[model samples]
Each structure stands twice: as structure tokens, then as C-alpha cells.
Target: MPFVADALTATYKGIPPSFQWPVKFCFYNSLIAFVLGAATGNVSQVDRVWTFLPTIYAAYYALLPLWPSKSPLPLYPFVPETAHPDVIRNYSPRALLMFGLIFVWMCRLTFNTWRRGLFNLKDEDYRWEILRGKMPPWLFQMFNLVFIAFMQNVILFVIAVPVQIAAMQQPTGLGTSDCVLAVLALLDVAMEFVADNQQYAFQTFKHTGKKDEWPGAHIAWTKTDLKRGFITRGLWAWSRHPNFFCEQTFWVLINFFPLVAPEYPGYAPPLPLGAGTSLESLFPIIPGLVICSLFFSSTKFTESITAAKYPEYKSYQQRVSMFVPFLTPVWGLYLTLLGKKAEVDMVVYGQDVALDEKKKA
Candidate 1:
């Protein structure tokens, strides 16, 4: 415990010992995921538990008052670093609120994963399957170790670090910003829910021709929905991936919740300059920026596969924004002014894309 505290402050003075437990957990799980995924060649090991890890991290902070001294919970390892007596007796109301929101998020994602049958132990992400075919076994294993297993777990832990921020601060009453954040968070979840339902409906109807499924059935499906080979209706029509857009927005909103502690024990500077907690911090923006960059790169990779499979998807890509909602129309205009929007729109709207090519000849 003393070693952890020393190592945490070895480089910088104010790095919180609260990170000890989570840091250990990250190491253990990353090793397990890499080993299991490498042995099985099913690299979705992290995906199965992704929904719950943050909630676990969150529970540590939100319920810090309830935790036994020196650990998040009894029998669990934790930093022996001193905790604020005030926080120990009466916890942060804001952390509780943040935990509640993330709990809702975890539930929504878990249910969606269940409905998609991803909870099955053997299931892997479709993208991983593609990557396996493209890369050599040695290189892919390195990727699994570095990116899929370790880096992703670290990111997941970092994103939840904001909640840990909540624990270190002095307890306070809920403020107006909390109300605004709660409202916007709910709205963000709602839009993502609709986007998910629309995609589920399309996939279901495409296979079973069953429009009777509860949430997905809300939309009326037509021949066009079936013809395009990819969704271009509902929120999907608004942005190629409205759900992803909301996902990024939700975390950024979570990052903005009103707890400013540039001097807090847990605060870590994005760069190495200051010796103590006096360091100016960019901690809040790190989670949002990291995730947005991940989404951008992942979206590009995902679209590459989709574009190759469906000829019409290229037109959809040209017509729609990848993650921003209203910007789809703006991009469509860009295609239009280039004198190709009509043909592209026809393709995206489920008309014959080849007809324009034939006409050009």
C-alpha cells in the first residue's frame, strides 16, 4: 500500500492513491482478456464486460462514504491514502447523480446487447472478425494485446475517472448545472435509443420480414428499407450513425458536470510539469476527446467494410454526416454543388444507382 502511494506520487505529488484499486483491476482484466482472446481467437473478451466495468468504477466513488476505510469495499484492495473526513461522512451528491446516469446508460446498453445476443461468451464483434482475416496472426495478436485488451480497458477506466473526480471533492448540494446535465443526458439517451431501435427494426425486418417487434415496429418499413442494404431512415437518415453521435455527446456532457478542482488530490495533469496538485489540469476534456477520436477512427474502419459490401453505401457516405445530425444536409449540399448529388441521392433513396452511370455513358 505504501509502495503504491509512493509510486503514484513518485512522478508527481498529487496523483491520488484512490487509483490503486482501479489500476490493479485494469491490469488483471487486461491480461485475462488478452490471454482468453488469444487462446480462443475470439477477441471480443472486453466487449462482454464493457457495460459493467465503469459502473463498478463509479460505485467506488459515488458510494465512497459507504465503503469501509482503506478500500472501496471490505476485502477489496485500495489505496491507503487519507480520505476527506467530510466526504467520508457525507458523500458527493453530484457523484451520486453521475453514477445514476451511468447506471441508466449501462442498463440500456446491456439490454441492447442482450437483444443482439452479444452476451453469449463466444460472440465477437463483427469488426474483429474482419480484422482477423486481414492481418497476420502474429500482428493481430499484438493488436489484441495492445489495443483491444490493454488500451481499451485503460480508456474505459479513464472515462470513468471523471466519476472518481467526484469522490475527491468536498460534498455539496445539487446545483442548477446538475439539473441541466440530467435533462440533457436523458435527451441524449432518448435519441440514441430511437436510433438503436430503428437499426434493430431494419435488421429484424430484413431477415424475418417481421415488423411486429415492439420498439423497432414503431417505424413503417417499405421496399426501400429492404432494398438499400443499409439504413437511411429515422435517425440513421439524420446521421449515418446517430447513436454514435449521441454516445460521444453523452460522455462529453458527463465530463462537463460542475466539479472544478484543479488542486484536488486525484487530479492528474495531461502533461508532466508541475510537481504537486497545483498543476493546471486538462483532465475533464481528456475523456471526451479520447473517445471522439476512437469513434472517428472506428467509424472510418466500419464504413470501409459497409461501403465494400453495398454499392449504394458510397452515395450514403457522400450524402450524410458520419456522426453529426444536422450536418448531413450540409454534406449533401456539398455533393449537390459538385453536380453529383442528384445521382447520389437517387442511390441513397433506393433508386437504381446504376441508371445514372448508364446515362453518363
Candidate 2:
């Protein structure tokens, strides 16, 4: 077992203990995911494991010190008696808090994916099929290898890199900022869960004519709601893709955990760098920034598809902010001042428009 484990992880020994196995994991998953995708003609291989990988990396950093000398993968490592309880009575409490919060995030997303039947090995995101039609066959395969398999895994790795910040600063125990961030991260997750369920409910109602299952069915969905061809009520009224907003924000909050915690010592979001400082100095916030970049590009691609499918979607774009809720009305008002208030309102508030029309009739 030791021999085989060493052989598997041999290539990564020179890398830091914290990042050693993760680089391997990322490579292995990317290779296998790309191969399986090419062979199976399903490039959504990475999507199935998306919820698990980041959490696994979180655990790697949080529990890094406990990693036994003999283990193959660095997960659930053996703890020695000499180790401080505070660092990992189970794990780096700061990183572990990030882990716990991320675990909850994993559960919510996994459940959502499962219910959507996306967990099926044969099923792929509908968007991929649309993309395939647009690109040449050879070029699409390159995209599958580059973006779908490799880069997505890299993003997963980098996004969880902030936990490495927590891991490195282990002696720093959880403080008020940790608790505050935890609450905010949970709130972010809660809102995302709501957005997922709302979309789920609307999608269910759209297909089955059945109201969504409880708690999630916050809005009493109607035929008019269905007629809009996309939701514009509840959180959707405020942000075009509230779920995407939360998904991106969750990581940004995760990045902040290590930054502001005074106990972590010398950490800040953007540290003061000497002219000699390497670009590595900025790695902490890259997670949040890159995830935001991914989401921004994804939203644009997705909305292009959506706008083509549903004409009213353009007006929704004009009226609602993309990822931030508070800016929604401001954007709407800006559009209104540009003389699009009525058209944008008619589409975005089609339900209300219907009610007033019926009343007048």
C-alpha cells in the first residue's frame, strides 16, 4: 500500500505539503474527466464533481497537519498526539469553519443537481449541446479539453486556495470576524438555496403544471408567471440570476475569512507589496475574482441563449442588475429615464400588467 501510494503521489513531493496532493488530484481529475468526456461524448463530466472537489481541497488544507506519513490521499489523515488541539482538535478551525460552510454549500448544490437528474452519467448541460452546434467539431473538442476539463478544475483549485490562507495561519483561532463571516457565508448559501429552489419550482411548474414542493415554493406561481418564460418575481425580480450572484459572492466571502481575522496575523485583502514582491502575493483574492470572471462570462453566454429563446429576456436584462440585488431598481430607473420604463416594466412585471388590464376590461 505504501509503495503504491508513494508511486501515485511521487510526482508531487517537491510541492508544498499543503498543495502537494491537490495538484495531483486536479491533474488526475482533469485527465480522466477529459478522457471520459471525449469517449462518452459528454463534456459535463466536471459538472458532476463540481460540488465535491472544492470541499475536498478545503479539507486538505484544514486537516493538512493531521496528514499521516503513510497515507495515499491526504484526506482524513491520522492525527498525532503532539499536535495542538486548537489547530485541528479536528482541523484548522478557521479553515475548518470554511470547510463546514463549504460542506453545507456542497450538500445544497449536490441535492439540487441530483433532483435535476444532472447526476446521471449520460446527462450533460443543455448549454453544452447548444455550444457544440455553434463550434466546429475539432474546436469544440479543444474547448472540452481546455475549458471544460482543465481550466474548470484549476478554478476549483484556486477558489479553495483561500482556505490555504486559513491553513497556513493555523494557530490563529476563530474570532469575531470568523463568526461574522460564517453567518454571512451561511446567509449567502441560504439565499442561493432559495434561488435554486425557486428556479426548480418554476421549472417544475413550467413542465408539470404542479406547484413546487414546500418551503421552496415561496411564490404561488401562476400561468402568468409561466407566460414570462423566465422568472421575474421573488429574488428574480431583483437580480436576473440570483443563484449565480450568490454562488459568486459565497467565494468572495470565503476569501475574506482569512483576510480580516486579526488573529490570523498580518493578513489583509490586498497586502502592501514591495516592488520586489512576486505576483504570488495577490493569490488570496484570485479565487473570488476568477470565480466572478467565470460567472460574468457564463452569464453573458447564458443570457444570449435565453434572449434568443424568450424575447422578454432582453428587457429583464435592461431592468435587473446581473449579480447585485440593490442595484436592480437603480438600473431599472436608468432604463426608465432612457424611455424604456414601460416596455421593460411590461415584460418584467407582466403579471401585474395582466392584472391591471383584466381589471380595466
Candidate 3:
């Protein structure tokens, strides 16, 4: 892990030393959030910051090049813009695009979370509350400090580092790959918007008893008790967590923007302005892997509760893909014919078969 961390650090050869301020801010904020969460018994302080950091980081990069003093930010020791023939005289276009995308995402996410009253300090994420009941107080506090507060913030910062990478590059011109990235990012954002709206409409109708105004494919599902449980139509039908899929894919595409330039090899990390690609370019993908792991664990935790609450959720699990869209049938067929473990759910449950039993523990 130490070597892995070092290798990951090596990937950002052209990042300015002044970028440390944002990292320090993240650490201090995370520490404060950890202490406050432990004191107040609400772990959502970290969640509140999640939507905002990418925009902050993107804006920081977009503005840093315009800073009036070079004395404040030490240039990248490995590379200088002078060595590149295509170096632009102004702010990076890539960073500006990222800033715009991140700012929009931040606004949408913040509004949705706030609309649910999650912005209130008294309100905690239901997932944390559920997990807390299952662990000793001391153990759960440690988990909150380590995983919830510290590690999650680190992952958030790491994933946004690609914006910095893109900013460091000298803009020659936009290429076909840049346009492709833009399209994919916009599509992912659209998918996430649709998924969130569908879920929100379902929940609002479920609570308000306003079935007449149910939007999208939700109208078909509301006639049954299952509508009170989970979404089964529209984007949800394509994947159990279409929003999660899109969120992960969006960042992966952002990371790819730095890689797509002809100057950087497909898998190589960006180098000094005049340098060639090395094997280290492979390291930038680690952030995407971190995000995928976070979603995998998150889905597992969320589904544990869902599977217990809704009996039909297991059936839904067997029918629909977990992350990737439209692959469940292929997985189901393989498990049935070859693996001889067709009865296995996407995730195996423990002996605590009842939701009440798990809650009590």
C-alpha cells in the first residue's frame, strides 16, 4: 500500500506545489467533521462536503494560472510550460469545462440533498444510523473516524485530481477525443438527472399519496405495494443503481481527458512539458478504481437493508444487473448452467435473516 501510494503520487508530475492548500483544507475539514460527527452523533458532515469539493478543486485549478504572483505557487519541478510548443498564454480551457460541469453537478446534488432536509445538522444519513445500531459504540466511532470522515474525503479529492491534470496540459487545440469526452460526460449527467428525478418523484408520491402526478414509468409501478419499496421502471429497470453507474462513469471520462491528448500515451501519466511517456501513466486510473470500490461497498450496504425490507427485491436483484446495464441475463445464465450456484443472490446474506434481527444486533 505504501508503494502504491508513492506510485500514485508519481503520476502527478506537473501539478503545482501550491495545490497543497486544497489538500490541507480537505484534511482539516475532514478532521473537524470527524470530531463534530462523533460529538453530535451525526455523520453527515462528510456527506455535505462531498458535492462541493470537486467544484472547489476545479475552480482552484482554473484560477491558479491567473494568480498574480509566481512566488506563491512553485512551478512543477519536473516540467515547465516553456518546453511545450503549444503552451497557451492563458487559463486552460479543459479546466474551465471541468469547472462548469462540476459546478452544475454540485448545484444539482446540493439542492436535492437539501430538499430532503439533509443539510440540517440534526439529520443524519439513514445508512449511518443503521450501521451504528449493528456495532458497538466504540467500534462504530472508529469506523466513522477512519472510513466515513477521513477516507471518503480522501477519495473525493483523489477523483478530482484529474481536473488538475487536465489544467496542467498546454492546450494545442481540441481534438475528436475531447468532443467525445464532452458528449459522454453530458450523457452521464443526463442519466444521473433522470435517475434522481425518477426516484424523487416516486418517493414524493409514495409519501404524499399523489399517485395521479407520478412521473415517467413510475405510474405503472405505483399500483402495487412494491412501489413503496424500490424503483423498477425507467432508468432503474436498466440497472439497479443507474445513478451510481453514471456517477462513476462521469469521473472516469473526466480522468480520460488528460490521457486522450496525443502528447500523453493512453495509459501513461502526463510528463514534463517535453518528456515522453513512462509506465507511470498507468497510475492515474487508480482513482477510478477507488470510486468503483466505494460504489460496490455502498450498493452492498444499501441492498442489505433493501433485501430485508422488500421480499421481492431478491427477485429484482436476480433479474436486473447490479452496476452495468443489461448484463443480468448473461450473469444469470452463466451461474445456472456452469457454476451450479444458481440460488445465490447477487450478495449472500448472513444468518441474521430478519431485518429486525440485524437491527437488534
Candidate 4:
């Protein structure tokens, strides 16, 4: 199918006819939700609500292929007569590839998240627990409805519009780069699956007492006889957060699809300065980059909390690299930088002493 049509169809699917209202309805409803979130200070709740928007949208698109009629309604003027756009229509093939990729990506992610116990009609993320506890009942409830539930949901849906837009511009044929991108995407999904499964298994094993009986003498334990926390084997050994690394890399690979399209020569640029040439060029990089940054920052913040709680975490930090594989290089760089800073400070102090001596003379 043509990418543009596929993206448009997927986007349209996100909003079902049953819920589709006039433009004013969307605007007013969203405004009210935002206002409620703001009044209650539940911004995180808004973010959580936004996560489900894509799944809801994809479900709508899947049903479109089953529709018998091709008639366009007043409300949905963009609905096309067929799954793929006709070649005579000058649709870009690159766009179609991007759309397909994103659809697959979204499907995999939504399914994974769902299986991980993330989808509850009335449930919120554990991170929100602290914030919710601080606010009054009425205020938190209002915030949850507005910011946590409504506005956040809309924003995530809107931000994802670019993938759909890019998909709509698919080029007529694939290229070497496109083939490479396909392989990368598959690897990304596979890597993520392995990481998630490994983590889940380790956690389950610990809970079930399987870890205690497992025939491995290398496993570390704390002075209190508790298992020293953190995954150190499998992909985790390659990178401290291999799952996060794969997740971000997957998005970067997905973004490469648009660049490989013949019509979108503007998308690809040569490295060592390989950066997007236009705002559209940056679309693929944003999601993974933003998420990874958040992951790292959160990890650091949590480490601080863990250090306070455990008293052994400082040694663990010394043993485990943050996001990258192995700690030697990072620690070496840290020492190098520290030495430079110390040298600079000593030089400045020495200069001050010399000036003082001259003034006394």
C-alpha cells in the first residue's frame, strides 16, 4: 500500500466514528481536560492517558480494510476507496514503507506494554504514586481526569502524526538503505523482546525462590544476605541498559526509512555530521532520543535513592557502567577529566600566590 494512505488510514483509525465529533467538540473537550489537569497539578496523569491513544487509533485502522463501502463522509473527507493508493496518483513509495514500519513498531510496543500489566482502565503508573499522595482527593481526581487522562492522551496522539504524515509520502521502490533499515528494525524488535524476557524471568525467578537454588556461584549477594540487585548477565552484560539501547536504536532505524525514499533525498545526510536537514528529517530521531534521555536521568535519580537506601550502591556503580557496556572506559574518562580540572585549579591558585608575593615585594 502507498505509505501516505496507510499512515492516514492508521491515524483515522485512532479516532473511531463512534467518538468522532465536530471540530469544536475536540477543541472544547481537550481544553476542559487540560484545565482540569492544571487545576489539580496532575501533569503525569495526562502523560499516562496519552500512551493508549495509538493502540486505540490502530484498532480503528485494522477495521477499515473490512469496510464494504468506499464512500467518504462529511466528517472524514480523507478516507480513500482502497487500501493502497493507485500508482497513477503519484504517491511516494518511501512514505508507504515508513507507514508500514511505524505500524509494526506501534503494534510490537503496544502488545509488549499490554503484556507487562500497563493497561488498566483506571490504573496509573507507580511513579505517579508519590505525586498523587501529596495532593488532596478532589485536586488529584481532577488532575487525573484532565492532565493525566485527557490532555496527555491527545498530545501523544498528535505528536505521532508525523510518522503518519511521512508514511503518506512513500516512494515507488525500495533501495539498499531501505533493506538495511528493515534488517535493523527486525533486530531491534528481537533485541527488545530478549531483554524484556530476561528481566521478567530474573524477577520471577527471584520471587519464586528459583534464583536461590540456581546452580550459579558467581551471583553476588549483599552483607545482609539479600541478592545484590541488578541484571548482570545476557544482554545486560553488553550494556547496562541494553533494552533501552535497543529501543532507542529501533526508532533511529525506523526514521531511516523516510530518508531512503527517492523523493526524500533531503532526509539522508553523510556522517560524521549526520544530522537531519529539515524539521521533518528530525522526526524519527526525536522519540528515541527523548525517551533515552529520560531513562538515563531517571536511572541517575533512582541510583541516588538506591544509594541512600542500600549503602552498597556506590560500589555497584563502580562495578556497573551506567548505559554503556563495561565501566573501564567511563571511569578512565572521569579520572582524566578530574585530573584536568584539578590541574587548572592548581595553576590558578599558584598564579594568585605569585601575585600576592609580588605585591608584598
Q: Which of the numbered candidates is closest to the native, going by highest lDDT?
A: 2
Over 1-361, each residue of candidate 2 has an lDDT whose tens digit, in order, gives 4664576556543444445557767877898899999999999999999999999889877776667644455444443344344434445678889999999999999999999998898899989999999999999999999999999999998899888778767644689889999999999999999899889988988998987664555676766778887888778888989999999989999989888877545542222122234655666667899999999998899999999999888888888898899998799779878998877787777756468559769
- TM-score for each predicted model, relative to the true structure: 0.86, 0.87, 0.77, 0.57
Q: List candidate 4 segments past 4 Å from native.
A: 1-93, 133-155, 158-162, 210-226, 265-289, 297-310, 326-361
In model 3, what is the error at residue 201, expressed in angstroms?
Answer: 1.2
Write out the backbone clash pairs for model 3: 268-281, 269-281
Which candidate number would show the highest TM-score if scored against the true structure? 2
lDDT value for candidate 2? 0.80
**TM-score winner, 2 or 4:** 2
Error of 1 at 65 (Å): 1.5
True lDDT of residue 294, candidate 2:
97
Residue-wise C-alpha lDDT for candidate 1, range 121-183, written one tens digit per residue: 878899999998999989999999999999999888877877766666644577777788889
The candidate, 1 or 4, that scores higher on TM-score is 1
Q: Rank the candidates by lDDT, best first.
A: 2, 1, 3, 4
Q: State model 3's lDDT.
A: 0.69
Query: What's the lDDT for residue 80 in model 2?
Result: 34
Candidate 3 Cα outliers beyond 4 Å, as residue runs: 1-18, 68-89, 212-218, 225-228, 265-281, 329-361
Model 4 C-alpha lDDT per residue in residues 1-361, reported as the tens digit of each score: 2673455445554442322322223334455556655565544434443434443343333233333334354233133443344322444445445456556666666665666666543554555575567789788777666655554555444334334334444445767877788878787777776777666556655556454323222333222222445454556545656677776676656555554555565333221122344654555455455555656766776666667765545544554466666563565467467665344322222344445547769
Candidate 1 positional error at 323, Å: 0.5
lDDT of 4: 0.50
